[model samples]
Target chain A: MSVRDENIIEVEGLTKAFGDFKAVNEISFVVKRGEIFGFLGANGAGKTTAMKMLIGISTPTSGKAKVAGFDVFTSAEDIKKNIGYMSQKFALYDDLTVRENITFFGGIYGLKRQQIKNKSNQLIEELGLEDVKNQLVGSLPLGWKQKISFSVAMLHEPKIVFLDEPTGGVDPITRRQFWEMIYKAADEGTTIFVTTHYMDEAEYCNRVSIMVNGKIEALDTPQKLKEQFKADNMNDVFLKLARG
Target chain B: MSISVRNISKSFKKVQALDQISFEVAQGELFGLIGPDGAGKTTLFRILTTLLVADEGSASVFGFDVIDGMNDIRNSVGYMPGKFSLYQDLTVEENLTFFATIFDTTVAENYHLIEDIYVQIEPFKNRRAGALSGGMKQKLALCCALIHQPKVLFLDEPTTGVDPVSRKEFWEMLKRLQQKGITILVSTPYMDEAALCDRIALIQDGKILDINSPEEIVAKHQHVIYDVKASNPHQLISLLKAYPTAHSVYPFGEYVHYTDQSGEFKQEDLHAYLAHNGLKEIVIQPTPATIEDAFMELAN
Candidate 1:
């Protein structure tokens, strides 16, 4: 398939249920390759549940999804192999040196030792972490750790990346630099799917989907969505949808 | 009914947390302390609430000095720290009653004060405080804080991780509380939230940068900001930054907020320059300053 024609993720009527309670109710959307798609919702709005299903970590009770051109249910392992994941919580080992953490994650992704060494060098220079390469991951500042976490996630060169609130506590300047990194990744044909409570970050996405009461309430470009809701910003757009 | 801080400074060993910070909260006024993390907001809140003594200077709540009137201040102030401090093992009702008993009052006595918030959480009164959702937990905490009907409320980043809906509802609750003559001093890292308060103090590096109403702060922005969008926003930022006339170029949402060294910037010149530089799908327009813009100006 051509890069432009490929949809990295395609979901139709995706639903997850625990007994009678539907955590994610009949959500459908398509994410194009190299696009930054934002999944947004209030706390307990089933965003996590839906995301778990898409990432092949949780089973869906009904409907269908295709991630990285593989069925979410039957090809879960293949899907996992082709995608990277990062969450608000730092996933790196705090006790390990920066180089050690990168090498370990690279090994988990089945990269060769030579490839790991080369990638580590490139990442260290790109992130300006050459001085801290030998320092323990825990001792670095939060902003540096966040940037490193993101770099490590992209080390394996996955087709798509999933970021769950990657900049929760980061300062504005750090957040801007983080977005630039995301843009660079997207530019390199890595589809980006992220979830965040920050409305400003939501505005940065190519398209955003807002969930309410376990269902997709609205999905569109930020500008179009704002115009549709007659709201000044994404926050107001979210408030109008969530309150309804 | 009011809070006054005069030259309050605190240090932790070698690191200075707060430096000569001074502000006044009028009776029943909703004041906001706005800044990023490690900006001395929590330190100031601690001193004002009588939880910690400043290394230097004086603070008073309701005309009572923090050092000498700790008991009086404790009696008349409601403090909700950034972290949820309620008993996780206790049920919602149990926690409320516990706080009431400690304050030498029953929930019934101040039922009127917490009715609006209480009724929302009443359905889940049997649930443990830990089991409640973030929004519900916030409401329950506020209810417990108000059980004694304190004259002043200090909320430290109360809506930090909350969703937009819950944040709006929480602000509405604060407005209601203000109507009941309760002075509120709230601190948050969210710049957009600064607008919700009656007055805001922008703080950074252990100092107050500016204090004014949100409108006044925005109005005081001297630069003419233009929201610029191009095919590639990241490249656009770098391009604008390298431009000789560009003063400040920062990424704001989807667009790059650009300001020129000169107040009088022409859109045609920018358009021609971008076109000459082989940029496409460019959109540039002047946008009104927001609380975040004002905060960014002061922060720099």
Candidate 2:
């Protein structure tokens, strides 16, 4: 392993154009291993478009990138197998039972039958879903469903996990618990990449990059960003950058 | 009073959405209704706007009863629901004009009222409402709501999905509107936004946890909260939870918000315990509480 291997994600001059519009205009960034990297942006600031490119789902018009040791352009399939993704819409099967949902996701990750059984039991126990394990996911509260969905996303033990606004509508208490899980994942050396509109969540990241008008406007730790912008919080810093 | 509610209560088939919730909004005040997803905010807004009748209790808008004075309230109040409700096929200008006509007025009559917000989206007037971005759609919805020159505006989560910049701009527009003496009542799940309102009512599980200005609410917290961080953040939470003096320990951003049962808690003792537990890079600092802390404390 070389110095570059220490970086879980590396991008330089990444650009994605739609006709005449540059959704992601020549952005560059790096994500160190075992760190929580927050990609912050206002809606329509090209955050999602950039994230899609990083996740290997969308292609960049011009760029150099590597995710989890795989080139994005040629090795997207290999990249997909090494990362987990959870979106705000929640990819869980609503009609499936909590236990069934876990098993189903594990199967998709190509886990063996015995491995799926062990992982499902462990996940259910960790989330305190013993009683509701057989209950349909739709019957659970929004918070519980969100936690379970996040856990399911991590079942395959991917090297990195990408969360898109995971706690958007969740209550503060539940959101706190979700962050606890995220911290646990990071502690275990799984690099975490997340995008959120919530500034408070942005503060939790080790490093954050803010996008404005389809370009990387600022990137630094939350504390430094606040100090550099002469602002009190990420919200104020974001406002200053966006207004500029 | 701009708005008043007396023992307002509503229930669905199985859930009691609001239970004896009562609050008053003073004239020209920017009041915030803060809560989570199932906090009954929408139900309250619906009742106040005369779109739904409360099972038990009454609400009044600008000295008019919501039940008997439905038409009067409808004419004087502007309501922007949680979801965007506009003619998707119609252009931005058409939506504004259509809403203005419904109130028996023209855009020119109230052009000054929405001028600050309208100008931002004026360049896209020819664009269909459906083609606008999230921020643009928000401005368009707000313009349509205000085209009628309502005395009181009821906005339900106006900036929920919008970006930080657009959210800031929207709040600035609200301040301008409030300066013109329009009492605004807004609801949002984001607790950080509570500070922007003149006063806020923190609602949870269909009950108002506490109603007061954001600063006052934070001042009311008797315990001194400490922000605790360590190399192993998760383990730190568990260790702090097991500590005898710990009153409440919850994950807050990059640190765990730890409050002790004993008024005089020792940081040295916490540091010793965390170190003994094999945690590294421990940093403990006293931090001022925010509206979020107050909400968690009250809800508990």
Candidate 3:
């Protein structure tokens, strides 16, 4: 791989303005391939706005970024095709059966009918959902739904996947199980850009960036951040930064 | 007693949301219900607040039976549902006034009860409740809940999605309210917050796992936890779980928390075993068990 191809996501002086207020003010970072990058910030902090721009759903006010080697400005359509996105608020359809939801998402991602069938079978087998593949998603427990939603997000095997608090309000055992899946994915060379409220989960990332009031105040690995801030854990580091 | 429940069970269709749940809260106590999603926390809250009836057993709030004296309980207790229950279209001040008037009272009558919490949102008094930020919305909802100055307060997952800083501040406010002698029954998915309550009841699948102070619950955990770290975390977890004497292996932050099946297990033996597997820099340190660990153990 060339030097440029190693970097899955690249941004420089990225900023987004809503009226007179700048939601994201000149933030820049690079996410390497197969690296688990955690985007940490308080509520109302520009994380979501910045993420929308990178996913090619929202336009930026200024600056530049390249996602999967395509410019977010001119080649947003290409960027969309090369990325997979899933959020806790809006994931799979609850009214649809597990198999139908997988087929629907695969179709939307432009997969062939034969390929969708194969993908559905593989996913159901991996998730141990063969018994309930025909059941409505609403009938399953919260933990099962979360795991199934994650597998569906990887249906197209995009270059980068974005997860927004994929384990909110889930059981502790299931939450850890979800992280295990994340580790396996990263090992297979899929860059992960995720956000979460749990600080311990932040420590699992290869590198984390804490945004305070629209600026990246601190960016480093969890161990280095803890040492630099002279704190015991990521939660304390966050308290010190966001409180300021 | 501030609250009491005896064999309370409620089911929704085929799913047994709450099964034979029973507990009691003392007067002026800060009691917490710690559980994750689909654990029937919300359904129990509804039953205690007199919004829904239980299929079996009986409950009471301040000596008032939940069913026989529903009106009396509703008049003297405050409830904040898991979801944002305030009027989104109304301004913060308007929402507060509306709640106060519903109980045949005014904000001024209970000004002292909520002065500290209300002041934080007063600056945004005219802003629509929907326009406020997430943290600000939580503060406003809290103020509305306390405007009636009830003897007992029920908060359902008030800080579930809130940031750490805001969550800390919100708990401090609750502490102050406790000092004012208002009994609080709160619920949360975050285990860290459970330690702040005077007593916590760990509930799952509509049954109580244990009810006691957070310290007592952690003390009851039988396993001696060790924070184990190695060069390769993925391999370390699998190896630890593969150990014949290993009781539990969980990925916690930078280290994988491991426990042995026997209390007499030695750390050096485990360290040497990992060293033999081509694992280097293997460090194992004993760590104190937390309520989260106890909850998981009890649930298992």
Best by the DockQ measure: 3
Candidate 1 lDDT tens digits, A1-244: 1125578899999999989989899999999999999999998899889988988999899999999999998999998889999886646899999999999999999999999999999999999998999999977656678899999998899999999888765656677789989988987889999988789889888899999989999999999999999999998899899988
- Scored against the native two-chain complex, candidate 3 gets a DockQ of 0.63
Write the residue-wise lDDT of candidate 2 on B21-86 in tens digits.
999999999999998888899999999999999999988999999999999999999999999999
- The candidate 2 chain B region of ten consecutive residues with least summed lDDT is B229-238
* Number of the candidate with higher TM-score, 1 or 2: 2
* Candidate 3, A17-59: lDDT as tens digits: 9899999999999999988899999988888899999999998
Q: After superposition, how far is residue B245 of candidate 3 from its true place, in Å?
A: 1.9
Scored against the true structure, residue A158 in model 1 reaches a CA lDDT of 95
Question: What is candidate 3's CA lDDT for residue B255?
Answer: 85
Residue pair clashes in candidate 1: none
Candidate fnat values, all: 0.55, 0.70, 0.68
Scanning candidate 1 chain A in windows of ten residues, the lowest lDDT window is: A1-10
- Per-prediction TM-score to the true structure, in the order listed: 0.91, 0.92, 0.97
Weakest 10 consecutive residues of candidate 3 chain B by summed lDDT: B229-238
Segments of candidate 2 deviating more than 4 angstroms: A1-5, A230-232, B229-235, B275-283
